[model samples]
Target chain A: MTLSITDVTKRYKIRVTRAQVNALNGVTIDLPAKKTLGIVGESGCGKSTLARMIVGLEQPSSGTVTWNGEPIFDKARNMLSSKHSNIQLVFQDPYSSLNPRQKIGDSIAEVLTVHHLVEKDAVQARIAELLTEVGISPELAHRYPHQLSGGQRQRVSIARALASQPDLLVLDEPVSALDVSVRAEVMNLLIDLRERLGLTYIFISHDLSMIRHISDQIAVMYLGKIVESGPWDSVLENPQHPYTKALIAAMPDHTEVGNNAYEAPLKGEVPDPASMPTGCAFHLRCPIAVPSCSTNAQTLREIEPNHQIACQEVK
Target chain B: MSKPLIEISNLTVSTTDDNRTLVNDVSFSIAPGEAVGVVGESGSGKTLTALSLLGLLPRGVHATSGSITYGGKDLLTADRETLRSIRGNEIAMIYQDPMTALNPVMKLGAQLIEVIQSHGGDTSNAMERVLTAFSEVGIPDPKRAYESYPHEFSGGMRQRVMIAMALILSPQLLIADEPTTALDVTIQQQILALVMQERRKRNMSMLWITHDLGVVANLVDRVIVMYAGRIVEVGSVKEVFTNPQHPYTAGLLASLPKASDKNRTRLLSIPGIPPKPWTVGESCAFSPRCSKADQQCRSSLPVLATNTHTDAACFHLMGDNS
Candidate 1:
């Protein structure tokens, strides 16, 4: 396995001068090498938090995250980055990620400069190489982030991400802000880079359709936990978790309107994470919710040969 | 659907910045209760087309020529007071970001009530209308939410409140300019659900402007593909998705990430980038990316023409001459 997350739980002290919000509850997952894994959930569902923890951006309150058979966070060291460049995160907003005042070439070169990977004389060539790798023109090197279109800017951000040539990539909704035409370009670029570089990725996004398109393995997240995990086709075709099914049903086809797309619509908004409901966190919106669903919590159990689901009723 | 509710005939909306034309001779019409989607890259002028209809152009922007007829009245030549009357009353708009559109200091109820009182013809039932609109658009706690400030609500809820405010007047037409772009997929699904539910109930015409073809394929009845201030293709959503006439539209549709695209490989992309709006966009605006562009396409702009029911702006489309 490339990465393994064991019995992870996260809770943030969101004291808004009034009350606290419990962002993440308990979660566990395992991701294999040279593969793409997708995490799908509503916003504030702790999906991003799970990603943050894996990249050491946030420490798990009580859990362990292993990378390549080693404990990455050094739970003993407080998960602080004391110069471990093994993992890197590509954020959602390309517009904000790159500095407006800085030139595109300088922005990308800074990564290599900071990582101490190349000689000062070779920085310009490295920047141009990174830009070409992401399909950006060399002439755009002098332009600022604001001068580039949304798609071009995202390409620059990707180039910056690749500057370090890190082992594992953590992409957080990289193409969700782009237009449909540009979205495909960026997604294709990521897939191409992964193959060429032999990279491992933890792709986090709410666009299940796109996730389903690229992920080798799929992990359905809900309320800060992996409710279901398996092969892409298996999880998509026969989603034992109700949340997974609801998410699949909610996806609108590239050609039809909304009202007809879903037969059993997801009901009620996502409950605030701070005060999660008792038992299964997803029971409130589950179409097949039962009496025991709210009284007993379920753990991930191997229901099929390669699939795991966290509901007792599914097995 | 007997008569068109909105029509744009040779609409050329220009800006004062060096007399730059933002929407060039754009023309289309929306039938009563029909849904039309406008799509393009970032600078396609789709938003400007929507803004032009409502007379809500940013400061200094002016329409150089063309007619904007809504409900059989000329919205282009209409007086400021008349334009004011048409806005928010006949053509309500929901922007992409509701947080920036709403008043952070005011309660949801007061903002919605203000909209109702302004265009809804009365103040007595305004509160009732606000609550009814809130509940209608899927806000869970109408009473409590009405009293809460904008900051108290979630992003999706705030957008719902914004939708409620925009739709409370039951405008003849609704203009949603990427209303769900800032929202997550699930919440966007919900918002689109609510919008469609309300549309079905009211049979209101809609002008949905967005850059996501995947969304329009599912939401709109027809499609209008825009490029650098001009429309390239217009057709029923079915025709556009199944067999798009314009090369740009086809490229865009092929580029959407599909749930069923298994064995993932390099997604098909139209190489190069969309042209800048200035400099008249010599030849076709998409010649920079189109694989089919020839000598004629590089020198002159193609006129938009209608064949059967579908309309396309291309010198090479189906080898048609207009």
Candidate 2:
């Protein structure tokens, strides 16, 4: 595994006088070394924050983040050693990811300069190589972010991320803002890059169809916890958790309708995050909820050969 | 056969900025109890066409030359009073972001009640009327929600409130302008399903302006693909999705990852952004981007031609080139 997160948790103190709520509670997962791991959840699911922790942008409230089986939170050690240099992140909005004032070549060269990988004379040549690596012309390196299109801007962002030569890239909805018209092109670019560079990815998104197309493994998050985790096709086709089922069924694709309320056409609303349900966080709207779910919180357990679900009613 | 609900003839809307034309001689119509979707990239004038109906242009654009005839009455020629009645009471609209569209200070009940009363509906127990519409849109705890403000609701709930307001008057025509653009995928489904269900139950005409073809495929019956503020293609949903004639429509649909898709390569992108008004032509505007554009296409403006239920605005569409 290239990335292993063990018992990661984040808790935010409530303002306006209320008890603190746990956003992520004891989450653990392993992302294999060259395989893309997809994290699926709605907004406020703490997936992005977890991503921030993986990339060393945000410190986790409590727990350990292991990159290449090495501890990341050890402050003095991380600063002294270059062991944590193998992980990087790519943001959702390509337009904002770049520096508008600086040329695209300088934006990429700045990273290489900071890392002390290349000399000043070799920086321009490296910029040309990086630009071509992401499938953009070397001439585009002199252009501004605004001058480039969305797809081109995204390619520049990928080039910048690749300039560090990271083993894993934390992708936070990289294609969410792009037009559905260009979604496949961008996704295919990522696949091709992974093959050529041998980079692992932690792809986070709210779009199920996009997740299914790219991910090797899938994790379904409700509130903050991942209620279900398993291989992609099986988990999406036969979701064991009710929350996963609702999210999948909510998608208006070419889906065959099931008779149960599982395909009940996405009624009601996702509950408030401030004051969550007492037991199972999803029981308030779970179509398959039983009497036990309202009182006893369910733990994620393997229900099938590889599928794990966190629902009391699944049994 | 169904009668047309609205017919826009040679619609030419020009912006006030230096007499620049936004929509040039665009023509299409919506039939009663039919939903027509308009698809395009951002700034492609899709929103401009929908805003033309309500005269909701932001103080700088105007319909220079067009006849927006609705039920034998030219909306372009209607007086302020006549358009006011049609704008809200008869022709209701729901905007993209309900949280922003709704007044944050006002209670949802008071806001919905105001729409109902403004439309000349019975005003007694106005809050009850608001709650009933909320219930109709499947809002849970409608009574509690009736007393809540816009901020108190979630993103999806805020949209439901907007839908309730849009349908409170039960208008003859509903124009939902990107209602689910701000929502999550699941919430978007809930919102679309609610709006579609309400429209079907009322048997009202709908003009859904959005960019999601998957959405239009599920909700709308027909589609109108627009570019540079002109109607490029108008046809049945199945006809367009299955056999897209225009290169733009085909590219848009092909780029989207279908629900049943396995893995594939070579997703066809149109190479560049949609043409700006300055770059648009007197002839075929899409000719520049179309791989199949010929000498005839570059010299003449393509017209919307229909063979059976399939219609498109391309000269080479007759040659089975899609």
Candidate 3:
């Protein structure tokens, strides 16, 4: 039930130029069963790339993705077929993920039937049961995806992912596409499902509030490298890395806005991932970066028992 | 208080086919230099209300009855030429997605110049003005930004360009319709701060329409909650956010995951989704999902009755209005 990612790197070769794009560089993390690990970063930080690799949607260029200490993507063994069903991904866009022409019940039942998770005759009953569990009416099972609201569509997507009874659900901005009110609804549903079903979650988002709300553990990624990792509260409230501090400060809250004189900390936009700097990718934007920060890339070193930071400035 | 800048009374917008009302009898007024936020989920007519201020309702949709009085003139009755001149000159709008708002093929400089020239006076210093606008919006290397197209700029940069374009002319009123929703959270904060800074410097009236209550709390002075084509509640940001009167408003405020909500297991969410404009009858549009709904709430719609420092359209308020 434990999923471990060890020094995984993903490189995508450009079709025409043949230059390698290092989407992820030596990323490592341990996601234990029944605990939530939140991966947070801005766009082009390789959080989604790592998510894709974890769910077996994309193979890693180097390193291993092990489920219970066994590699899941070994080509010769074809471990994906055996391990893929245990991990599922819920995408950001519910509108495009589900087939427009298919009915909700048929879509959910299709996953069960493909994996043979349920008996043939009991498929219809199971579909209804799953629909109701996700807070959707059983009657809406016959309706098409378009007939459902955004919240309902997301629920249907979640039901499909839960059909195989995945132990780890990789939610990539699952509620980001939803409206504010419905986001709370879907988030609560996920919370309920995880407790009832005893599931582990890899929650990815650029929203700081959401990350702080759900993550038991958090890993802050920058340019494919995790700059900081620790228990959620420790990393968020007492952040070690300067980038994490800037990110937390930049969050728009009630008190932050009234002080109009407050200065914005970060400088410039994120650097192009393809042409990243030799040392720390965030050194260019890091306010407190030192001389050595530009030449040597820091590796994750444990400062506390479970807290690790990859910044050389943090002792 | 100073005279209200723009007053909207009984504004009803309807689709051409079957005259289905998308915005129903909405009334509110913005004070001069005040920031007002309109909040709701999709299909709440918040966008339509913002669009109606400039008489920019799409084809097949028109304001059936109501008056948008701004600067001693009715916007609904204003001529096309008047609207055309007022738009982007005295009243600018920033859309949700900067990608679609900008042209893909045209150079950023050219697009900006074209906008400045259309509200015509002189084209001699157009390049300088464009660069100035870019610098004002904190875009580094204005020369390179001018030469590049929209696609070359990132989402945050594109939005900055859009903001620069909107404010280049120094509009008296700015209607930003969910301008930061498409951006990352940090980027969204930057844009919100930028908008607030520019508004104060120019003393411009801003109507920020969004669904994020937390964002509204930070950015605006007053908040108006809209539901299925009607105004559910309106109050100061402090009053409404701290003590929301309408059930829908209360539900929306409770639903957000705040910094205070850390380690909490469940969020209080409204049970059902909003109803479609066509599906609703004479009853309160929110009664289907409202927990405190009674027989009267299901049969008759409530008018906006005055509450403590706020106005809400709910039959279950402490005072009996009907």
Q: What is the lDDT of residue B310 in candidate 2?
A: 75
Instruction: Output DockQ, candidate 3.
Output: 0.54
DockQ metric for all predictions: 0.51, 0.40, 0.54
Q: Largest DockQ belongs to which candidate? A: 3
Query: Which digits, one per residue and each the tens of the lDDT, describe model 3 over residues B177-291?
Result: 9998877666776787788888888999999998777677778888899999999999888777777788888787677666755566567899888888757878999999988
lDDT of 2: 0.80
Q: Per-residue alpha-carbon lDDT of model 3 for A59-151, expressed as tens digits?
A: 889999987776766531453345337778999998999999999999998888876787899999999999988989999999999999999
Candidate 2 global TM-score: 0.93
Off by more than 4 A, model 3: A75-84, A254-263, B262-265, B318-322
State the weakest 10-residue window (summed lDDT) of model 2 chain A: A254-263
Show the lowest summed lDDT stretch of 10 residues, model 3 chain A: A254-263
Q: Which candidate is the best by TM-score?
A: 3
Q: Model 1 segments beyond 4 Å from truth?
A: A16-20, A74-84, A137-139, A255-264, B318-322
Ranking by DockQ: 3, 1, 2
Pitting candidate 1 against candidate 2, the one with the higher lDDT is 1
Report fnat, model 2.
0.39
Cα deviation at A23, candidate 3, in Å, is 1.2
What lDDT would candidate 3 get against the real structure? 0.86
Please give, as one word, the docking class of candidate 1.
Answer: medium
